[model samples]
Target: MRFTLRQLEYFIAAGETGSITHASERINISQPSISTAISQLEQELDTQLFIRHHAQGLSLTPAGRIMLMEAKRLVEQAESLYAAASEASEEVRGQLNVGCLTTLAPMVLPELSISFMSAFPRASIRPHADHQEMLLNGLHRAMIDVAITYDLQIPADIEFTPLVDLPVHAIVGESHPLARHSAVTLSELAELPLILLDLPLSAEYFTALFMKEGLSPNIAFRFSQPDIIRTMVANGYGYSLANVTPRSDTALDGRKVVRVRLSGENRPMTIGFATLKQLKKSRLLAAFATHAKSFISDAYIPGMVAPAMGQKKR
Candidate 1:
């Protein structure tokens, strides 16, 4: 082929975004570089790939659309070749794109990533944090190599390896009546005003706990962010439920909150790694998986308090 892979990559990015400026921003390159690469690629292929509009950006011609698909496949194959070479050489070195659950990102990623990179100096990590659905989509689109998330609605194409079980806990302000209790049941909480962390599948998981026991939570407020829910709960807006217990029993604003274990048969969320089932595990990915297993367990989890002693895994 007359065109280099870097040129093809720039062409693909430009074609996908339909704008040289947007493509440059997406890939962190200069606009002139992207435009030059795409122009070079078109010349090598002997075809006009894009229809340029004044101030409107670029649009893919029919030929450009077809070429884009092949370019993506070629890029994937090249990555696979690199992975195979790394495996044969027994070297854990490459850019491993990691997706993480938004709620868990702040607590888990920084420590785990730092330690892993420290161990394998040649390996680098690119982290992306979002909701579970988006994380799964990223895996399908080949945008992320692996995800750190809960075992929630996992499709057959994705594989999950559980590291630890995080049991549900009721978070209440220090001045709340139930704050002093060692453990509280859902029945006791069902009638109280509840501040729910309402993020896609996560909301369903929390509300299901109430539904399973023939109870409905008095959801007085709902927020997508966990920290917001914590702050609201600390301000006595309402009590909330969570599985990941932060080490600090305080809100972002420095107000005290207490995490009380939820009594009865409540389902615990399993924290683990999710990867595409059909994709071959690269050496770097395998190494990161091994590191994750050792770093997170029932006895210890980064940025969160260990599960309560004698807490049975359900």
Candidate 2:
């Protein structure tokens, strides 16, 4: 075939992103290279693949849309063939597209990815951080191979392997009245201002905690980013709930934040790897999954405080 797999891959990226610039960033290739690949692919296929917009980027011609689907299937099959070869040789080597919850990515992925790469020098990982729903969508669409995330609203089509249970904790400024308490109840927290980490399904999970207890939080602020919420809590804006507590009892701005265990019956979120049920694990994916299982647990969660002893998994 005149068109190479690399060309097809570029076409897929461009078709998905709708922008050569975005596709280049997605695949870590130069804009010129992607542009050249797409142009060449269209030439080889003897058809116009995309309608070029002056500045708005490219839109797939109906033909481009059709090719994208086939290209993805071809690429997946190629990857599986390579994975089988690697498995036969007992060599874990390939690019793994890994997704993680945005909240967990900073604390978990860097260390886990670095160590995993160090252990298997032949392997490389590309990390994508997004909300739970987006991550799941990525898994279904084959945009990501696996996701490191919580067992929150997990759909049946995805399989989650539990590694650790992270119990929720209330974080507050050092001077906050409830900060000195050994543990605080949902009722007590409901009375105070709550700085909510408001991200898609994550927001639902946090709010559900309050709903389960028949109490509504006195939400003072809503922020999508966790660090901002931590900072807001540290500066005494309001207390916030979290599963993964930072090892340092301070926010990015160096303000002290205290993690007090949530008192009474509350569900702890299980951290684990999620993959599509139907997708066979590639050798690189399997190796990474094994590494993740070994690396993350109750005793040790990279860049975060270990789960408190005697914290029962729900």
Candidate 3:
């Protein structure tokens, strides 16, 4: 190959950190050396990988984005090949780039990270979280090796492995009249002001529940973050709908909320991992997936109660 692995590493560092200076600091290399590698890479590829921003940093162009994906896949494959050859008798170890749905980050990512790293000390894990679209984009770009998110709208290029089923529930403050009920239905719940989660595709899922019942939700507040939605519901601003329940009813602000099961024929969302359909699962990725499936079960998700005796799976 005309370009060396060292050049690809330098380019990846600069692309991730968005700055030649920061990339140099991160890898303990000189800024000029990093710049030279990137320049040489661009010359060989005949494409501008980054658009320089004065005093700010660099931004990856469309071509840069495509190249970044292939670069990551190549580097990961190379690392896996070396590990397999050198540690044939040893434990699986290498780098992992994992992502989670933004809503699931606060609820589950920390526990999964701590558990995985504790078991595989030699393996490096980088965890990231964003909305559904960005997470899918990351997967498609090979920036994230695997993701744990609800089955909202997965593209055809991605493959999802369902691990847990989380049904929608109504969130309300202790003082709300519906708080006394064990479960609430959409017809009755829709009469009250709704504090919408308002994330991409997520908003549609929540609202569609009421739409199926021929009812319209009276939306009082809309927020993209789940914690904010909980805080709003805890403070009695309005009732909200959620899938992942934190262990505590109290929000980060210390206001308490209650989770009431939703009644009716609404479909539950499947929580699972997403990866490129064609990508071969490295030992590191397989090991992580095994841990993740066990970490997420019907019995132990925070803020979520155990599934019903005859609960269905999708």
Report the C-alpha lDDT of model 3 over 123-155, residue by residue, as the tens digit: 877778889999999888877899989898898
TM-score of each: 0.79, 0.85, 0.77
Decreasing TM-score order of the candidates: 2, 1, 3
Task: Please list the C-alpha lDDT of all candidates, in the order they appear.
Answer: 0.90, 0.89, 0.85
Q: Which structure is stronger by lDDT: 1 or 2?
A: 1
Clashing residue pairs in candidate 3 (N, C-alpha, C atoms within 3 angstroms) = 245-303, 246-303, 247-303
User: Compared with the true structure, what per-residue lDDT tens digits does model 1 show for residues 241-296?
Assistant: 99887778889999999888799998989999999999888889999999999999
TM-score of decoy 3: 0.77
Judging by TM-score, tell me the better candidate of 2 and 3.
Answer: 2
lDDT of 2 by residue, 172-289 (tens): 9999998778898999889899999899888888899999989898999999999999888889889999888767787899889988889888888999999999998777988999
Clashes of 1: 0
Q: Model 1, residue 252: displacement in angstroms?
A: 2.0
| Count of clashing residue pairs in every prediction | 0, 0, 3
